[model samples]
Target: MDKVDIQASNANILKDHGSDNKLNVSYGGPKIGRYVSASSNISTGYLLLSESPVGSVLYKDKCGSHCVYCFSRLVAGYPCEACCDVAFCSPICRKKKKASFHQFECRYQEFLTGLGISSIGRLALRLITSKPFDYFLKIRKYLNDTNETLESNRSLITRNLDVIQFNAHEVYEFVRKDNQNLKPSKQIAIGLAIYQRASYMNHSCKGEPIFDNYGPTFYFKETKDRQKELKDRYWFNCNCQACQENWSLLNDLISIPKESLSYNKKLKQDSFKDLIHFIESNYVDGKMPTESIVRAIDKFRTVCYNMGSVHYLNK
Candidate 1:
């Protein structure tokens, strides 16, 4: 692989090193497996990842409950006619699943769970199945080469293992704690998603968690010790202004009506359309769409309201 002179378009924006634990392929990257950084000349609206998420899958716990294909919550979900183990949100999802990967993995559903596949194991399996047969052939041939060094093989395996599991993030961001019908006792991770670009983003105590559409993620937790919860789950200290100054969760809380809250969120969603349109129209190659990008980020200002959507607070 190293002998090939191929270069990715995102070479400047992203660097993939062999592994964080065993290799420092990305020069000067801290705690590195992969890192993303935009070049100074890049524009603000420059897209980093055109399309991503190498792969994902529904966790065994969510199998019967969520769509085996799209991982959406089942609403009169369409079942795999052949097996009772999985269902889909729509016939389209079911068909797509069957056409792509599910058809191949269906027979194994009976015992893969019994084999006790961990979160990483499931995603690894997804990674394998998501690829074309030729892709595996290429990898297998490389790994099996008689002249291949053990150190190279070990390095590649270590890197793949970390990227597949350690950096994998939960995805249940939309399934708010109180929003679903069939409630879990606590925050439930419905699936897993790997947004490699965002791995380079630093977590701020006040920042909203980033999630992709592919897999499971967490939502609610006791808000009593916000900082502690942040530390335990996210590995960050909540030294943001709220925690440093000891702000109250309900201090002078303005009680926005449930209807208004929903409306505002919708408005926020619409503003994104406007922002995207403006960037598409006004942005010129090599020039930053500074104003539009700022508008996009500012749209999240109201997300603080999610702290307790009236429905969840009332519950």
Candidate 2:
């Protein structure tokens, strides 16, 4: 079938099955992929994919004052009278969370706290309790029907369970351990949430569009990483451009020579303004050229670097 026909068929099937129209799970470039792109013509750098959490959990010790539902940090929040440990930014979030998943977990809060299970494990538990067994059966059937090779294993349910059990590990953040110590110790994981579509994103130490979480909506950025942590924990080698080229090679490719352009204040100001406007306009709600956007951003950074303004590049 033609690409248009195939997409139409897929959409019809999803609509028939009562799937959320916002989510599109299909087979393509990377086996089974979740995408926000409706067509190949759509530009890159657009906020393409987004999914609400299937399950989420807050850290028992950390984020105590943050809303259990939205993860909003509140100076003062509406406390859960039953658990005493949880709080919400507003009554609406509290009500929604309780109706959706918190009702199942509220009574077991103490037990979960004592178990010291990783956030993924707790999220898994929440998933099981919040969703009916028939839900997974439907998901499995849908996946099989889609003919996506990403989940070709016969024991799909078992594999998902295994992912929850083994793949989920504790995440740590650097924090001051003691007042006297100049160096910081790694603090324990503060929170975690599972998004079915979000999990499908492949790893890249230098993957384009960098992923960042604001509440539940994730946005992308470009940065450098060794992928050592992801490899050790998630067990995958990233093949993204940054990973493949390494920082030195990638830098060389995008860098502008110092002699090419003299540091003209007007040129610098205009270029920066144009680049920022283009990104904000094209990358926010509409489609964008993924490679082109990345290159433009990199070139802008290179220009700033060549002008001997290292700090301005990040800003």
Candidate 3:
């Protein structure tokens, strides 16, 4: 997926829950149900929302080569000036990282490395030090209110993510593999992030035409047993059209326009530029003409596959 540089402060549409119209949420036990808001009805490949991580941590191995704060590749960027261990993409990030949680981590990096602390342990340590005792105490006053979102102790800062196994997303730094001059590197889990909002229905949609970017999960099983496997693995079933109607797999697929895309087709050298033109022509006022978004994504996916980019976007 193409990453957009956006911040809540500057993005006009993100202010004051303005973007909330794109999603609908219902309290359905611990697993809250979320779908596209009927009123907003986003086209395919629409961005739902952007979230700042409540708490995040880099794996021990990534501390030196990658920015511990932003997780960007470390260059002549700022390193923990004292310890010279963990690095950051910029001096600004280094300053913010110090204030956020790195000041504490920097002090004990050597001690913690000796203990061979795991990434999860490092993240837990970050949580423990990221906030002060008074912050927790202040939130304690809301425990009695049923209307309070989540009144637990961990909820003091961010909603409790105690059941982390069900929510934490492993982040990766993937490079575009289509280019020959770009050096290919081993794909590794660099860090983990917890968004206040949860991952949604898009994930479990059946019969995805593209590759799965969320890394490998289970095998691409048949439609009959896929739902059961998804439920058993993820503990929830999706309500996407593909899942509901039991759409056939990619091999038995029909292209978007039934004439434009193909599984085995190769695209021209200027296909990427053509994609930009298509989007410029079709994507207007933050929305694409109905079903056109699907065509756009499908065409992009087809080009990426032909170019030998890491196939990870499944449907």
Candidate 4:
């Protein structure tokens, strides 16, 4: 199948919140329904959750960049004063994340308590407050009701807390930094989360490393990986076709070149379909083995560095 077909499939899976979305389940008596916590370490509690040993590492890197559609951004609209230093779900996760984003804003806990916000809400408040002052300036205009709005906002924050804190920077700088040795795909995944949270990066039709589903899990891999790496993988996890056409659309936003972008600004923008055709026809090497495919994937890394909406967007 082509990239569009693959991405639409992935997006649908997430919207449905299938089994993969239910990472943890507590068993109860057969008579009683199992209490499922949508807010957990694995599910990311409206906040971007990371797998790094340091709690919420991805969160810290992208804390300053806020996307309009981001869960954290909406939650941040409320002041999460109570749970500034606490994790949203469990005490253990709270303790693990104590030193993360909390250290800087923990003192603001009173903001939550006085406002009747929950611990989770408090954390969200802390995150927004920690952002550039401009964020608050933008919020102030939309705040509407101070007393009622703040109260309701606080209520939402306290629910669905994570076990880990958002502090991933202090895990030792060396440890927190990206591991260069990881497979390129894994590294891009980490970067993707970071940019998604911080920058309003755009997508491209000619993008590489499309996001796809291998049955239960979501993945962003080089197009060439389709034959070798993705052979056994299922195709339903992805719903974003743009993602299927070019996973690097995100990475390029982070790595684009200063000059090429200016030149691209003057050139005609490529349509998604056109880009998809270009990538399939010009980039692919059917005769070469895995190494050749890998090489082409690496070459496309420059796409991230190219100047275009795919690399940088404010909203």
lDDT for 66 in candidate 1 is 79
**TM-score on alpha carbons, each prediction:** 0.52, 0.53, 0.59, 0.25
Which has the better TM-score: candidate 1, or candidate 2?
A: 2
lDDT of 2 by residue, 1-315 (tens): 122454445454334333344334444544433332233333333334544666667776655756777765555798876778788889998888777677777898778778886666677677777775567777785543543357545675456556654323333333333434322333335566666544533311222333322211001323233465445555555555444544333223343333432231233432666665554543453333344345556545433333321111111
Model 4: per-residue Cα lDDT over 17-89, one tens digit each: 3233422233234432232233223311122222312112223333333221121222223223354323233
> Top lDDT: which candidate number?
3
lDDT at 29, model 3: 34
Instruction: Please identify model 3 stretches exceeding 4 Å from their true place.
Output: 1-20, 29-38, 114-117, 132-134, 140-161, 177-188, 199-233, 237-315
lDDT of each: 0.50, 0.50, 0.55, 0.31
- Write the residue-wise lDDT of candidate 3 on 95-132 in tens digits: 88777776667778889989987666666667677786
> For residues 90-151, what per-residue lDDT tens digits would candidate 1 score against the true structure?
98988888877677778887788789867777777677677777777778856645554466
| Residue clash pairs of candidate 3 | 211-312, 211-313, 211-314, 212-312, 213-312
Candidate 4 yields a Cα-based lDDT of 0.31
| Model 1 steric clash total | 9
Using lDDT as the yardstick, the better of models 1 and 3 is: 3
The TM-score-based order of candidates, best leading, equals 3, 2, 1, 4
